[model samples]
Target: MYVIIVYDIKVERVNKVKSFLRQHLFWIQNSVFEGEVSRSEFQKIKNGLLDIIDEEEDSIIIYPFEFFSEVERTVLGVEKSPIDEIL
Candidate 1:
């Protein structure tokens, strides 16, 4: 499945969350990540995030798609960290 994660975390834990997400997704923009992953990997990501975030201060939104093609992305400005697939 493909997942897009958008987060608004406290400054103290912001970098921690960012670093964790980077291991599983493409860092497209500030606090935004999108990529494909296996089911097990997805579970691991959620678990890891849960361990890092303080529920009272952090916010994370995850959008999961069965196929990447299903996401109709529109970039109006400079695309940061664009995904370039060679396949």
Candidate 2:
């Protein structure tokens, strides 16, 4: 499945979280990542993030795409074309 993972974490642990996510997803924007991951891989990624985030202060959101073509997007400044590999 295609996934977009966004995180809001304490500043002190932000970089660590980004690094951890980079292993599983493409860093699309600050604190935002997107890519394709298998169900098993997604579970692992969630488990890994659970280990690093502070429940009281950190939050992570995962959006799964059943079909990339079904998504409608709009961009203004710094437009980044959709990654071909993702299609």
Candidate 3:
């Protein structure tokens, strides 16, 4: 299954989260990161995100088994595509 993890992160902390995902995930596109990961891997990613975010100021959306096109379309207005690749 595929995942589309969206985020509404503060500007300053975006890079940190992006860097973290870049090291772990495959085919990251926009703020919507894509990858085929085991349950444990997903949890790891979630944990990593939680550590960087302030919770009150920053937000994230993690979608699993999502269609690529739907993921792409959902983020039309989000406008921070740091990641773009095919899994």
Best by lDDT: 1
The residue-by-residue lDDT of candidate 2 on 1-87, one tens digit each, is 888888899999898899999898887777888887888998999999999999899999989987666556676688454555455
Clashes of 3: 3
lDDT digits (tens) for residues 1-87 of candidate 1: 999899999999999999999888888899998899999999999999999999988999999999988988888888887677511
Candidate 1 vs candidate 2, TM-score winner: 1
What residue runs in model 1 are displaced by over 4 Å at the alpha carbon? 85-87
Per-residue lDDT of 1-87 in model 3, one digit per residue for the tens?
A: 557678878999999988888776653455756666777888898898999999999999888863445554444555454444343
Worst 10 residues of 3 by lDDT: 78-87
**RMSD for each of the candidates:** 1.4, 2.0, 4.4
lDDT, residue 50, model 3: 91
lDDT score for residue 5 of model 2: 88
The per-candidate count of clashes, in order, stands at 0, 0, 3
Candidate 3 versus truth, CA RMSD in Å, comes to 4.4
Who is ahead in lDDT, 1 or 2? Answer: 1
* Candidate 2 global Cα RMSD: 2.0
Model 2 lowest lDDT segment of ten: 78-87
